[model samples]
Target: MGRRFEEIDWRETPIGAISLRRRLDPALDVDVYEVKLDDEYLMSSLFTVAEVELARLALAELPGADLDVAVGGLGLGHTAAAVLDDRRVRTLTVIEALDEVISWHRRGLLPLASRLTGDPRSRLVRGDFFAAVNDPTGLDPQAPGRRFDAVLVDIDHTPRHVLHPSHAAFYTAAGLHRLASRLRPGGVFALWSDDPPDDRFTGTLAEVFGTVRAHVVTFANHLTGGESANTVYVATHARPAGLA
Candidate 1:
């Protein structure tokens, strides 16, 4: 129906040159949106089960109302939109390292752009997610030291495989401790990974959170003509023993 392939936007960011492209898939008979960081494929609208699940599975761990949530990446706003879907979420702060990606959403370059930018409960912030966790200001800059009910991350490929060297620290126990400090008691932390369930990372999370789970999310893969899977790690911050 449309052009076979079109690059919506391309910008050089601090991390790399990120690009947004839309192409018509003849097999699926639909338009697919994709994001690329330099030569590496970052995300695609064709397969987003895990991205949405990152928010759904994370929020499911918390049984609370009027929840404030933070999302690490704003790639296509899939994960962020999933968070807003739950009516219980009171506020959402999306911390994205690349301002170019945020501009794509605000400029309505993607399908979910309007939904994310129009939503009054959602705020798109230009900041580094991993850096914020390791900072005293925490995730939300406006409210320093502000804690959230849940933190869902979908930035790097996996804990071990990171885009930059700086991200490796956040996967460590010490770094996780810092991340845990940004959450309220009983809050949850979830991450989306391209690889299968990693036991070593689970052990590292166990040291920081009370309960940890590695979820293998499978979705139909049109390109492969089969199913592909991604991992979602959900960890809940333990409440103080005396607290009820």
Candidate 2:
């Protein structure tokens, strides 16, 4: 049987045209909310296990309760929704450069839209994640100088592969140091990559954080009819010598 797809909203963003769509997956026989940039598929609700795992795995490494976190890129609210699933998450500041993506959440086009936006602990901020990292004020524009226990980013495909030229900087050692500077001691930086783990990126992360590891998250591929995987790189920030 075939399926149906409906475009919920579309808008011109800084990079390209973004569209919010809902489609029925013939293979899964389920509704899949999709976010596309022009003709490229940005995210699909049907295959969000890796996205959800990105948040869960990052938060799992952290210890204790009431943890502050920041999520870069709000795609269909999967990652953000996963972060909120952890009761330890006291506050979540999601940074999205595209205002159109933010509007999708505000407009409640997706199932978790209202929950992610309306959650007392979550704050959806429309801004550039890369720019904010370099800024002395940090990601949350509302509360400057605030630091998070964990920063889970799933914007671009990988460090070597990126959607925009400007985002490439944030994947560098220098740029990552600036991001680490904003983290509280023992904080973590977790990133999602479409490709498998790359040693080059891990080396870059090691320059800033104490330890880095790549986790392979496997999921079913409807198109390929097999299991494929995505990589989640988690790096733990090390406190300065004698700082503690």
Candidate 3:
């Protein structure tokens, strides 16, 4: 008999009802896991190319060793896992607003749960990405005013679209400036957007950072057929005059 769909776990977060579900995929002939917030799909193991690239492209921008990084939003831990793959990384702190998401990993309900929790370089932190950015000891409570080599974010669909109303402010000029201050002089900031790049947002980034780039990452979508693309926005905090 075919296995039935299972609701692994769920919680009533400050945002809304969030759930984790597991089901078998007939097409792929494997078990698939999904995360949903209220009526919207937050993430799925089936579609993670963009999440993986979000970490890769961000690290690619910062070419150095012993890098300190903070990844905003830990959906299924794909982005956090990808960041930990680089041997040069000295430390990785994943900031997640939802306590339930962290519990899933700690409870080993997620695929990369063991890998992420066991890794000496990685740690899951319970915090809000938007509010943390503006705080002095936002990313690291132990070390106030501490900065990282790069910050990779994939919380919302786009700047125009956010999980909460409070998040919309972070996409603006004032909010971005505070975020930039948390990075080192040559630090890199990368963002994953569901929609294509917008000039208005790019313009705002340009105002704060020395360099801004939009990367179109194409991946095969088995569900939709053919290929689909997402935008990865990359910016440098007073970048040096050189390429990685």
Which structure among the candidates has the greatest TM-score? 1
**Candidate 3 residue-wise lDDT at 102:** 95
How do the residues 75-187 of candidate 1 rate in per-residue lDDT, one tens digit apiece?
A: 98999999999999999999999889899999998999999999999999999898899888999999999999999999999999999999999999999999999999999
Candidate 3 residue spans exceeding 4 A from truth: 239-244
lDDT of 1 at 225: 85
Q: Give the Å error, residue 37, model 3.
A: 0.8
In the range 1-244, model 2's lDDT, one tens digit per residue, is 2348788898887789989888788778888888888899888887788999999889988988999999999888899999999998899999999888888889887799898978999999988899999887889898899989999999998888899998898988889988988789989999999999898888888888898889999999978989989999999998778965
- How many backbone overlaps does candidate 1 show? 0
Rank order (by lDDT, best first): 1, 3, 2
Tens-place lDDT digits, model 3, residues 21-67 = 99998888878899999989988898789889989888988876999
Q: Which candidate model has the greater lDDT, 1 or 3? A: 1
Candidate 3, lDDT over the whole model: 0.90
* Candidate 2 Cα outliers beyond 4 Å, as residue runs: 1-3, 241-244
| Least well predicted 10-residue stretch by lDDT in candidate 2 | 1-10
Q: Quote each prediction's TM-score.
A: 0.98, 0.95, 0.95
Model 3 clashing residue pairs (backbone): none
Instruction: Give the clashing pairs for model 1.
Output: none
